[model samples]
Target: MLESLNESKKLLPERVAEQIISLIADRELKAGDKLPNEFDMAQQLSVGRGTIREAVKILVSRNILEIRRGCGTFVCEKPGVVDDPLGFAFVKDKKRLGLDLCEVRMIIEPEIAALAAERATSEEIEELQRIEDEVKELCDKEEPHMHKDIEFHEMLAKMSKNMIMPNIIPVIQTGISLFINITDYSLTKETVRTHQMIVDAIRERCPQAAKDAMIEHLASNQDKIERLSGL
Candidate 1:
């Protein structure tokens, strides 16, 4: 039912935690799922209850588990990484934060678009087209579609086929989206036009054009933010 850790390892508690994570994955244990008690886990893993307790403590610290005083330990709603991994809370200047996010996108997205142009499969390009179409539809209706807007960018990062880029894109975009959604930065004819250019460049397999379009797109966004803030 659960994985057993190697007894030979000196770091029993850590190994126990790893084994618990393996169990969660293997059993498809989702958020709010109850883990077995310390006694049962100890028996299953051939470790002392104390080791199990230590492992549970570690999992709690990592937000993988939560303790209810009377009910016992359960999984957290969303686990693994915290919501704001970049410490955006500590940043006092919202305008500066928005500018910084734009700078990061300018650096990261152009290369991502170029890589995606080179490596993207037919299915990936088709997905990008679908996203672009949705963005156009929302823009036509004059609707706020920040989620769709971010989705298109995230999909581009995924098309790059680089594991790290996909992860980094979400974190940066979350922060950027906070500012864009709060202001009038997300919904506009220029946004749809620029994003369409990026998608078209990628679909045509023009890596240089894709990169240029992506840079131009983010630069447009930065310019809009600066104009609105007069900064």
Candidate 2:
């Protein structure tokens, strides 16, 4: 169910968008859940179809919704999280950027891994293992595994089960990308080894082991950056 908007609202589209977001929360819609058609939404919210369209566009820009041609608008996998939330792309000095991201990861990711060991469900751990396996396979074949590596880290964040953890994914992703580019995959073997250690620790539900493994994993990246940058 949706609420009707006051006609005197200064920005009807914005008001309508907020109402639609409320409707989404009220209905407990999950990612990929399709919203009611434009006509239906307009009728329910007592707004013009144009207002609904504009509102949907706003949600789309915020990464909360996606419009699929010939289908319908649905929630994003990581709703309300933008692709580059921290604007890492605009930084001119990538070497410094990579080191800085490594610093941030050192502070946050080990704790995240520990939380994941504490909270992740069996199914989530299994999924993480699958991603880890995929990454190792790619690395063994000397193929491009950066995406899978990013997926592995992202899966770890989701396993943390902290509402805020998933929002930090883009930062982790950016850091991973920078590491791969800077190292030129020179640390592939070390990375794969540390990833397996992390997965093993998580599978055994050893929080300290998982935390230490994550720290080692990130520290390896930092070391590589420092050595390469002649620091």
Candidate 3:
């Protein structure tokens, strides 16, 4: 009977582990809170130690737990999603307000462009050109070019081939688009010129040149936003 019940689809080990994590979260378990030993926890939850171990491993990898060499596991001193060096917490909760998200992008996108300039491949450069061309074509069409514009920046970040970069790129783009859409500002001729400068720097493999171009592009964008919204 126990085995049959344990095999139920809804009561899987992962679910049980999630429940434990939720409990700790709800109870506001501080760092150094000692979780019950596997044996006792298994008996109490009617699940095996393996489930708890797997759950602990997930949290550990996410920096929520720290398994000591000889001592039992404990919550990390700062347990949360690891922040990228660039302060990348833009898309964590889907409920984040749009303006708050844009503020995050106002900080990150320029740097991503600079990195892409330093490391993008020929094929990636071609892709960015294609994205730019597609946007030009779309501008003449009935619909907006917002998605394509976002894709362009995202592709530029992917060109960098940095491990965590691709992940942060979309979050930044989403925020940028939030403001862009509200303001209805497609890439103007001047914006394209700035991007072209960055593209040229990338083609020449000049990291500093790319970085400066990106900074200028973003600064000009800020000026445009003020002109559009007076914010």
Best by TM-score: 2
Per-model TM-score versus the true fold: 0.75, 0.84, 0.54
Say which candidate scores most in lDDT: 2
Error of 2 at 58 (Å): 1.6
Query: Candidate 3 clash total?
Result: 0
lDDT of 1 by residue, 28-58 (tens): 9899999888888899998899999899999
Answer with 1 or 2, whichever has the higher TM-score.
2
What is the TM-score ranking, best to worst? 2, 1, 3
Model 1 lDDT vs. the true structure? 0.85
- Candidate 2 lDDT by residue in tens digits, 1-231: 676877764688888888888988999999999999999998998878998999999999999999999999998887887877777778788778877777888999999999999999999999998998888888888888878888888888889988787778656667557544564468889999999999999989999999999999989878987887778
- Candidate 3 lDDT score relative to the true structure: 0.66
Task: Show pairs that collide, candidate 3.
Answer: none
Q: Write the per-residue lDDT of candidate 3 for residues 37-64, one digit (tens) a residue.
A: 7676667667668877876777777677
Off by over 4 Å in 3: 1-103, 140-143, 179-181, 185-187
For model 2, give the 10-residue run with minimal summed lDDT: 175-184
Backbone clashes in model 2, listed as residue pairs: none
